[model samples]
Target: MKKKDNVDLLLIEEMREEEPSWTDYDMDETSVKVQLTDTVFDMLLNDTISSLRRIETRLT
Candidate 1:
C-alpha cells in the first residue's frame, strides 16, 4: 500500500472504539483467539496489532 494509505489506516485505528472486555486480557494468542468469537474483539485486536506494526516499522 501507499504511504498515505498506511497513514490513513493508522489514523482510523487510532480513532477506533474499543470494548471494555478487550482490556481484561493480555495481548496474547489464547486471549485473542477466544475474543475472536466476538466481532468487537476481532476488530480491536486487528487495530491494535496494526498499530504495533506501524510502530515497529518506524522504529526500524
Candidate 2:
C-alpha cells in the first residue's frame, strides 16, 4: 500500500500495534474546580466579545 503525501507510516504502524485501554473509551468520574476573580473574568469576557465582533464584521 502507498502512504499518502508527508504521512507518517511508522507512527501509524505503532498506533495499530497498541492495545487501547479502558480509559480510551470510558469517561472518568472527576470534578474540576476553577476559582476566577472578577478582574480575570472581565478580561476573558472582553476578549471573547472582541473576537466575536471581529468575525461578525468580517462576515458582513
Candidate 3:
C-alpha cells in the first residue's frame, strides 16, 4: 500500500480538539500523587503498550 503525503481533514480536526492550550496549568506534585491511583496507572500503561504494539505490527 502507498502512503499519502497529506494528513486527513478529520484527523486534523480531531487533533485540534485534543491539543492543549497555553492556559492549561501543570499539575502539582501533590495533586499528581493523589490522582495516580494504581488502577488508573495500570490502565494507562496497558493502553500505551497496546498502542505501541499496534504501531509496530503496522510497520512490520
Candidate 4:
C-alpha cells in the first residue's frame, strides 16, 4: 500500500479508538454536540477520501 494509504489507515484506527470516549455521559450538551459534529465530519471526510482513492485508481 502507498504511504498515503498507511496514513489513512492510521487515522481510521485513531478515530476508532476515540469512538468510545464520545459515549461518556459526563460531557455537557455543547461538548456532546461538538463531538457529534466531529464524528459526522470524520465520516464525511473518510467517504471523500475513499472516493478520491477510487478515482485515482481509475485514472492510473
TM-score of each: 0.39, 0.40, 0.41, 0.54
The residue pairs that clash in candidate 1, if any, are none
Instruction: Give one digit per residue, the lDDT tens place, for model 4 in 1-60.
Output: 699999999999999999989886766878989999999999999999999999999999
In candidate 4, which residue ranges exceed 4 Å CA deviation? 1-27
Alpha-carbon lDDT, every model: 0.81, 0.67, 0.75, 0.94
Clashes of each: 0, 0, 0, 0
Better candidate number, 2 or 3, judged by lDDT: 3
Model 2, stretches more than 4 Å misplaced? 1-36
For candidate 3, give the lDDT. 0.75
Could you give candidate 1's per-residue lDDT for residues 1-60 as a string of tens digits? 699999999887865655455675656777777776687877889999999999999999
For TM-score, candidate 1 versus 4, the one ahead is 4
Model 3 lDDT tens row, 26-54? 66655777677766989999999999999
Which ten residues in a row are the worst by lDDT in model 2?
A: 26-35
Best by lDDT: 4
* Ordered list by lDDT, greatest first: 4, 1, 3, 2
Query: Candidate 2, residues 1-60: lDDT per residue as tens digits?
Result: 356632677777767777465346433332111234556788999999999999999999
What lDDT is obtained when candidate 1 is compared to the true structure?
A: 0.81
Worst 10 residues of 1 by lDDT: 17-26
Ranking 3 against 4 by TM-score, winner: 4
